[model samples]
Target: MPQIQSELSFNGLSVLYQIAHLLASGKDLELIMSNILEILETSAGMKRGMITILSPNNEELAVDVARGISETDKRKGKYRPGEGITGKVVATGRPVAIPILDAEPTFLDRTGARKGLKHSDLAFLCVPIKSGNVVIGALSTDRVAVQDAVTLEGELRFLEAVSDLIAQVVQTRRRDYDRIHALEKENLELRRSLENKGKPDLMIGNSSSMREVYRQIGQVAPSITTVTIRGETGTGKELVARAIHQKSPCASGPFIAVNCAALPESLLESELFGHEKGSFTGATAKRIGRFEAADNGTLFLDEIGEMSLSAQSRLLRAIQEKEFQRVGGSDSIHVNVRLICATNRDLETDVREGRFREDLYYRINVFTIALPPLRERGADVMLLADYFVKKYSRLHDKNIERISTPAIDMLSAYHWPGNVRELENVIERAVIVSTGNVIEGHDLPPTLQMKDASEQGERNDSFENLVAAYERELIVDALKDTQGNQTEAAKILGTTKRIIQYKITKYNIDFLRFRRGDSTGDDE
Candidate 1:
């Protein structure tokens, strides 16, 4: 008897050491738990081992991992709190040891794993897995009945230790899952907000003029009609063309863009139509052209009014005949393509001056969508500014919270001659150079401050007031950056802490508002 007891003690210790190693393996939680149960069955004489975890809502327990049970049986093994042996253990936060499974009326073999076995010859044991004072789940197993009470108690105690290890892993995994879910939710919300602000297409504006542009895009996108986008430079003419192409039936095909003004007249023809090898001095290999590349798709010709009259003749033939010969290649390489053209110059004036083909202009002018300049979109300036601020803040790794009121006035008052593209560049530069959380008026370019005489007369502010306002804005921004720490603010401003205090008093600034949580500060 002494020899047998010594072997069991040594085996129990070995089993516990293996369980500890398995818990620290950093593997998938289900796979690790399954491996742990397999070890218990083979080494510790346990059988039909299973682990059950509480659901997220904590209303029911379901089998999460099991050994010696079919997957179907494992899935069927579920219980409410206090419903069965497993449920009772988790509900009461205690261990249960049934000496004979047949004698326990509460023993419900939910999995039916022991169906063929004589119930009188089986023993069942279960222990609660707890995280702090809350029971999160239960671990259970059964074995051939043990006659000695001490041996049954020993088996139950070993299972309890294994459950404790599982509790730690479960808690850690749940925390990681929760964090990932929260991040996914936050991302979904941001995408929805962007979509709402730019409804018909992702162009970003809610003004009446932008809404009209969106309506025109929607009206003409489903058809095969040629589209001409008319707008000033930097007014998002290419963006409008793209929106039409994306909504068109040819969205799945390639979208090729070319700038007629950027290419010389000598190369413009060869660019639109493929060049045969050995056709020209530097035409080394057979090169595919933009029209062929955009087969079954959209070809965006920007600044189309700049194309030479010779190139315009070939383009008009292609539009009329739906086919054209490559430069220096007589083979009429036919292609099916949708054409979208953009131009800032008036084609009517060019036609009269013989700079543009009247026939080609009429063909591309089947559908026209005019983009609104940024200066004309009343409230859209602020919307676009905020959008650019958020975009550049993330790109440059800045924490810019908001634009200051004075900066807003400056942005609203300035005429955006360069349009939306210029505004985007301005915001990106401001984000890169800002030293605090707020974008102040001084952070903007000097051009915005240079107002015309008529504009200056309307405001009629003195130079002294302007200087004071600028100074107050700088001091407030510094305080916000330092979290109301006047010493840090003063150091950032290249002044003494006492000067910062005096300035704060002079400006009637609530420095405490910048501090998070506790609204108190001390400067050393």
Candidate 2:
């Protein structure tokens, strides 16, 4: 059997392909729609192609895109639902075609675009743009008439297909707008909550040490004073910098940060202060530096102790005089930036050893804030762990609820050499490994399981300690052998099920972890 060809002409197919390419390019939706109208007018034998979008309140249709129509006429074209041929299609969710526009008295020339053309010389085709069975808008185009019903029907079918494509783009843009609107509302709410409570909700802690840090941030955030943050690596110095910037008078300005240790001495000067074109061998174009980019905002210099002595002299001049010349240029540019610096190395020791500039150190050390390590924060560990568990569970799309008691004990007992950053990594990894709602001790890395020599030596033969340790070991072994079956585990241990249940509760063991392919088990 021979296949029948489509009524779409070769030029019409080419125009549709062009419209599809524009959609796939991910250009601005308004520009894409305008180009589609242009293609329909020039190549598809259609004139005055127009796409009208529903207003925000859904009260009327406004011309969003048009071709071969005057600006005045486009502005005049507004239709309510069921008002005319274009409005009727949107109201009824159907397509309409007029073979002879002159005979149709209902063809309201609201746009005045057909002022000189007679009704017998043109045909009108309109289709509803639907999103999931709901008509959101309409697409209409007119063509010069040969006064035949079959030709008008074919053009109507082609226009209907184009309307479907337009509907998809409209729905995608609507969903994206809704998502962004929701996120902006959430951010505003959080900012309002912080202002109402007068607290630094971004940093999570309530310990005495953290309280002092908060006090420092509150004292200096609203001013333009320079700050120097002293702490070990992974102590969240960047977070403190951001909190300061957010609360400062320049909250709406840019915040630029650079690591002094990341670049070599040769490139550090250009990286911080920028350079003029043709200044060096590879300097073919002019560049803007961090100091200039951060003007009217905050500039955070991380690892400041690693800056070279030559760079230190230039940086001191820029800070004290509030100006500096670009590399290989004599023009001094002025800047008004609030500077915040951080370093793990002791700057006082560096000054005494003649490695760092004493004058520069005094200039940047106007105010200092120190952050404590994770091991020193005490109960804050469990709080941070809980926060991280929730964060990673959402990111990984898992159902991890909370850390088990035994796992919390293990986390609190270990000395965090890498500080809070290390703890975050450990929790993130455990969230990935956990199979149920609760994170167990077995889900932790092996390094956390190994007891240090001091801890091992401290476990003396106390009456309660020895009994608890032995009982925990026996229960774990039995549960492992029986594949997490409580009845079989009790029989193997030669004890009643009641005793086994009591022991499991006392030790906080997650027996379901041993079961095969059980990701949704009840936590006991």
Q: How does model 2 fare in lDDT?
A: 0.83
lDDT (tens digit, per residue) of candidate 2 on 1-524? 11223765645567667888888998998788888888888788788888887754466887767887878889988999888988888889888988888888888978888888887889888988888788888999888765666776767777877787778987675576566765675466447635532344458887656776897899999999999998999888878987898899987766677999999999999999999989998997788788997888899999999999999999999999999989989999999999999999999999999989999999999888989888767678898899889988998999997899999989987888888899999999999999999999999999899987666766565467656756776777788667678888888999987898888989898887567555333334
lDDT of 1: 0.83
Residue 245, model 2: Cα distance from true site in angstroms: 0.8
Model 1, range 18-110, lDDT digits (tens) per residue? 989988888988788889989988898788898888876576798878888899998999999999889999889989998888888988888
> Candidate 2 versus the native: TM-score?
0.52
RMSD of 1: 26.2
Q: Could you tell me every candidate's TM-score relative to the true structure?
A: 0.50, 0.52
* Model 1: CA > 4 A from native: 1-200, 452-524
> Model 1: which ten-residue window has the lowest total lDDT?
1-10
lDDT accuracy of residue 34 in candidate 1: 84
Runs with alpha carbons beyond 4 Å of true place in candidate 2? 1-200, 453-524
